[model samples]
Target: MPSKSPTPGLKRRRSGIYWCATHQAVQAGFRPSVARLPYSLENPDHRPLIEANCQRLQAEMLQFLANGGREQPRRYDGTIQSLSGLYQIDAASPFRRLKHNSRLKDTYVLKLIEAAFGKRALSALRIADFYRWYDEIKKPKRPGGPERVRRAWGVIKKLRELFAYGVMAELPECERLYTILRHARFAQPARRRMVMRLAHVEAFIPQALAMGRLSLALGTALQFETALRQKDVIGEWEPIPAGAKRGADDFVLNGRRWVRGLTWADLPADLVIRKATTKTGAFAAHDLKLCPLVLDLLERIPSEKRTGPLIIDEVAGRPYAESAYGREWRIVARAAGIPNQVWNMDARAGAITEAEDAGADLDHIRSAAAHSQAATTQRYSRGAVGKSRRVAEMRLAYRGLRNGP
Candidate 1:
């Protein structure tokens, strides 16, 4: 028989390398009968002569398939490429490692990663981006503030690890990215670090108490004043009173119970604040005792069968989540005529400052705050210490003049 014509169904083309579109295969060598094989864009077996050309064609094919053989979707390939290439190097890749190894929650970190990806290319990002992001985020209406920037920094640092010690060891691009982010501007305006004052706490408490939303307001205030974290507040029940001591000290609301006392025994002894396994991962739990004022406020709240959370939403009947409490605390502050500028942590710092001003020893204040280190407590007491020193100098000066020295 005459040589059989090439199979009618198998279409062959040989512009560069022999390719069989009909069979979805490509020839490895010149032989017509060479084993027909499927193509892989990423596979190294293709012996691609030009890496860029191969990558471009592979990307086009991917786009063709992704678009269902229609017109390419706008910006889809660019988004994917940006995320997988540049963003992978600058933020997303390291964020993934952080999520795996750190206490931070994946959702929070992922959100930040997405933000970074949408912000700008790693090569194009400047320190100004960091500052703008920080400022935009710190607004009362915004979801996060300096705390978020701090957490994002952690995520960014984690991203740096991919270049510092990993398969991408040869990539100098990562080092450049790190150098840029290191000088990145914060999203919020940078404030000179100042010591917190007792007046700050004294100013906020009465207003928080007057809101009639004592459970949440008092809970938040207590966390701030006592340096207790939200989790620490949620781990124990408000104490209850038995007999005539009930009205004398404790009060019942909605059939629940609470007592007014500030001691280790009255609080959850087992509570320990550590880095949260949630997003942000900033503050953790601690064994914080309520101040007397916080106890008095708690006494006014109605009791409930649920005693686990020191602060619970009476309407929702659930423990206070930090985000929700933060929003609610702002409302309470506004209603109580307090400036909206004060934050929960600021309140805690204010308490420390107040104690220092009152001559409380640094060690005692540190213990009361349950601070892990003395230096952190000292930050709160710095103003008090400075004032004390000035007062001593003045006393000496007056004494010397009186004695005609």
Candidate 2:
């Protein structure tokens, strides 16, 4: 006779145990003990062992039938629910390791992971299941073309990161998880950085401050000169350092809870400043030289506020959030008749361009922008420097024409 097929969810291990691998089976104050499960055929009196295990298995099956064949999914052993539970605890927790902003994105991406697999057995996930999910998410693309896929790319990448973390923490099947998560691929595009004109920035700032949008006014001013990100300029979720003198530039920004943005000490000098926390996760300070406009803006800030964050939310008495600050910037942009094509990040690109126009060398622009590679600095300063080279070539062409005649 052909070998009998094993019942669904039943599993056997080399340790001579027949595991109840069934989902949502009630225990009724009685956890399944090893004695209640099947033993190996090699055991002494193996027939009796098989009979007893069969009797217990029958009893559970009858109970499942009486209970309408479905039990509540609990945080059982070796299930995704259990994995998610473990993820929320211990020193290895993702929340603890990631910065606040990054943590927020991770939290959402993790929710997507949990929503898909939370009720499923952790040991049961396969590469095929990941492929199905990937196909489902790839259907829609916005008119912006890359934006939708860009976000999906982040989600997919972050899902891989979660599993990678699981591997370090030694969660079950982590190596397998890594392979499956990577199988779920999404493409990210090479996006061009938008640059703004100095005239557009000039028209926007005074209107923003006049409208009591202090965050927009101050943040734009700093980003335009320092070529810093909004988080680096607006002091995202950082607190003043402990037991430090107030109203002084030397006051530290070492916070107990979070410290991922511009701190007071990050801007010790008025003209040239640096950041303790940066996007690259480097501990060393990244220096930036302030222009006359940036310097003037720095001097106008209240001493009490200055001693706290490099930039503070005057109304909320906290740091300005990315969305809230973006809204304020839009309002100012509209009031100043700036085109809708502008973004806060464009200011940094414009700043790099300005450095090029002022004849700052490539390395100088690279340092001012805090970019890791000179190529990235060149990319931002492309238009200005390219034009200068063109003008020089044009001058040579004119001289050649006159001399040839």
Candidate 3:
């Protein structure tokens, strides 16, 4: 069995956060599960905050419990160190429930945060401090500066996202810091992720397939037609249920969901592609447009084949793997004279961009793109990224008569 009583005091460590030994002892005596213990976490920088927060806080906690008090929210005076400790204790707290995967990510990012400001008072660091840290990340002597900045920016973004007054309100100073950080841009020189362009769809992949790289071309072709993610390409499909609110012609493919992707048995009767969710922080479901090209591709699937990846690598005897899919794409792309920068995954981005550019109804794009919210399509942009670099010229033709050409 664990020690029933810990030494009575509050201590701060390099990783920040102060601990109350007395409160811990009290909790151990109370028989609360690890997830339930009311941790007396505080912060006093690298020094001790209280020689014995254990005695006083422990007494207060016990008295409250004895008086039939509800579960006290784990909190501490606002300090980065204290906030860090509270973060751990409250991880399993009811008010701030986090899924296992999300908690794991929080833990990893917390490590980076603790290393930088664990022992410091969370308020001691100003918003400018974070900005300065981002600056250092951007100018790192080593290579991969862009990636480093991106990762660090992600940490800050998560911090803002996770800051909730209702869940963990003890960190006033931390809250203030987040509020300040929110107003500022944390990263610079926006990094552009290249995707396919809309206008090139007609000639791109047909040229690739003509070059005789079947698997890669087919994989690219399927993504182009359906706007399905790479994982969905090899995942299952199934029709919507009989009693649900769907058209008789409407079908739902076995979708890649939050936790798992679908398989062969999930194939639906019709060609509706409904990805229950997407990994890209949004969701999408699109009825395959009845365009001739799209229908032609679907028709190619053997009628007897009721399930499995819509696109396949028959040579592998399983779904086409992502690596092989990308590798073959590069081969096909090179011979087809496609630019090296365009990615196999860019098809979805290209399709969404095209759908928006073509003035497809907003709801149509939203359903097709699986946007988590309707307004998400507002960022759905198109046209060349290089338009600014090109010469600007405008020629307006009047309704009936124009200047001689």
Candidate 4:
């Protein structure tokens, strides 16, 4: 006789435990307790175990019928895991509105939350539970490694976001838990003060070019000189939507399309670039003629070669993935004697700092950096003392004028 088909919502695992496929959770009290028990349902020796599992399944099925055959699709049992599932997958979720990169990161953090406290009911959670998880997650993943305080902080931040979503979704107990944790404080990692200088960029360029990485060199120079982010300089690969029309500019690879970076088209005229930034949608226009070093680097690329993306990974003929760009940039940076602390991303900060030192107007610097706020530009203008010196000079001049110098 042909083997019997499993029920619609349940399947037998290799360990002989029947899992509720629809619920994505094991059926309650259905797991085997004995070690190394024989799991063959066809064998007479395994009949007792099989019958017991079936009895549990039958009871649950009758209960489902008794309740008018309706159950929440994911069977929300008032657990954080169920709430997280709804938050992540529900069409009405705010999570769906997050940026592509943010969604990817939050998804990873959500997994950590699920693994740590998935089964815990929202009502049972206390603020102390969050602190305890914080202390544990901040510990190094590997023995003797540096403490993962940053990673732990990131998890806490995502958890807070999850709770906020739960409140919006109006899930049971979520609003209460969210209210209790409203004043909670978690540990934060120290602010990053590392910055890359023009000298580092200059050295990085020659070394990158020597290593046959023209794209890396161009990208580094663009970020430093134009105060553009790495994403705006090199673009990002996003998944191509199904049945979407592929345009001439679309770079399709493995079902993903690269979009929204500097292109030759953005530089409509020689020695000039005009483009809206990706993150803030701020318009950023720069005359390459004003950026001598950037001009020099641009000159090295022949006119014909500048037809497409200004930064293309020579090896793959595609724009560099963020991580790949960082890895390769490090090798060239290390060879150029740039300290490890000075990350590739610090190029924008370095540009802002340099502008501040050069006594550029705060608003002008903010515009060039495409920052929506002057405070954001000030934050990036780290280690520049010119502003203080300028303040002192103005005060002295005012006193002299009053005293008739």
TM-score of each: 0.48, 0.62, 0.55, 0.79
Candidate 2, residues 301-341, lDDT tens digits: the string is 77776655666656656555435677767878999899888
Among all windows of 10 consecutive residues in model 2, the one with the lowest summed lDDT is: 28-37
Please provide, for model 3 over 249-338, each residue's C-alpha lDDT reduced to its tens digit, 9 standing for 90 to 100: 322322111222434343455655555543564555545455455555556556676464455555655454324667766776767677
**Residues 18-72, model 1: lDDT tens digits:** 2222222212111111212223334453333223223333444444444555334
How well does model 2 score by local distance difference test? 0.60
Task: Using lDDT, give the best candidate's number.
Answer: 4
Off by over 4 Å in 1: 1-172, 179-189, 192-210, 234-290, 301-306, 381-391, 394-405
Question: Per-residue lDDT tens digits of candidate 4, residues 218-336?
Answer: 88988998999999988986655535799886677534578888887787667678888989898998988788777777778887787777788888787775467888899999999
Ranking by TM-score: 4, 2, 3, 1
